[model samples]
Target: MEEERNTYLDELSGDGCRIGGYPIFVQYGPRENEELRTFDTLLLQLDCEYECDLMFGDGGIANFFINEEDLKKLDFTKVLYNWDCC
Candidate 1:
């Protein structure tokens, strides 16, 4: 029997909040276990304008915003590196 690949996002309240017009959900994955993962980082572009909020394990709340210029210069694959180096 194949073990079911568990997915997060099944535990958040139905009406938590909306980010960049997409509803935020609690997501769990190998990379991010038991955390909130937005549908698209693009939503971070909305920033404070939208109500999307991320609560880090350290209890840090980060409001993300990505403008056209920021997006153009962003390397999605190296997000962790950027975060670490910055």
Candidate 2:
């Protein structure tokens, strides 16, 4: 039974994907220049160890899975780079 369950989960995670929970989407205003500002807002609301897939273009969208352990080790400041100024 455990083996079957594991196999099912593996199948579900195919190509680095899983089908559970809803994604959190965030959009920044045109006037906002800092990327971290939006990131910080989203990061604070999420728990650690949460799985997140982010997409940014005209706007920013983040899909996070709650995981408390992962949240503790995340360094948002270092991760969100400022390429325009750099």
Candidate 3:
């Protein structure tokens, strides 16, 4: 039981890929960039998944960010795409 609880916690702490959630960067955060800071919405995050044979150059994570206003307007022309690895 204790082991199971720990496993759950570990999963929650892990930075897995998701859509429309916070980004889990492998390196510097989005806050480091002024332009990225304005793009508050996380559109997509693709993390390295060995089980699914998906990778982005040595366990890199890909992220797409967009401004809340732009997202609400359904304008993806100015979305920012970034990726990083360990």
Candidate 4:
């Protein structure tokens, strides 16, 4: 059996990150009209005003989306990086 993806904010609410009441996604695919595809990661559809006011607008840049105020706000302990430093 396949394991479930607990990659949603609701699934991660226990960590204390503000969970947007609406559904967010960890979607993967190429951007519209581009050849080099952007990779997928946990992302929030953000309001253009940057209020954290819960009004979601166009999808924000992944880094900006995960940021609160000016500090970085993700717990990467569960994430694995297999890149070679060569």
Best by lDDT: 3
Clashing residue pairs in candidate 3 (N, C-alpha, C atoms within 3 angstroms): none
TM-score of candidate 4 versus the correct structure, residues matched by position = 0.19
TM-score for each predicted model, relative to the true structure? 0.20, 0.19, 0.82, 0.19
Residue-by-residue lDDT tens digits, candidate 2, 6-33: 9887664322322334323344322145
- The digit string of per-residue lDDT tens for model 4 on 1-86 reads 12344565436432222223332333432232253222223233332244564322343222122223222445433321111111
Residue pairs with colliding backbones in model 4 are none
Candidate order by lDDT, decreasing, is 3, 2, 1, 4
> What is candidate 1's lDDT per residue for 1-86, written digit by digit as tens?
22332223333433332454333323322224333332234333111213444434332222333343445676443231101100
lDDT of candidates 1 onward, in order: 0.31, 0.34, 0.85, 0.29
lDDT (10s digit) by residue, model 3, range 24-84: 8888876587756888889998988899999998989999999899999999998888998
Ten residues in sequence with the least summed lDDT for candidate 2? 77-86
What RMSD does each model have against the real structure? 14.6, 13.0, 2.1, 13.4
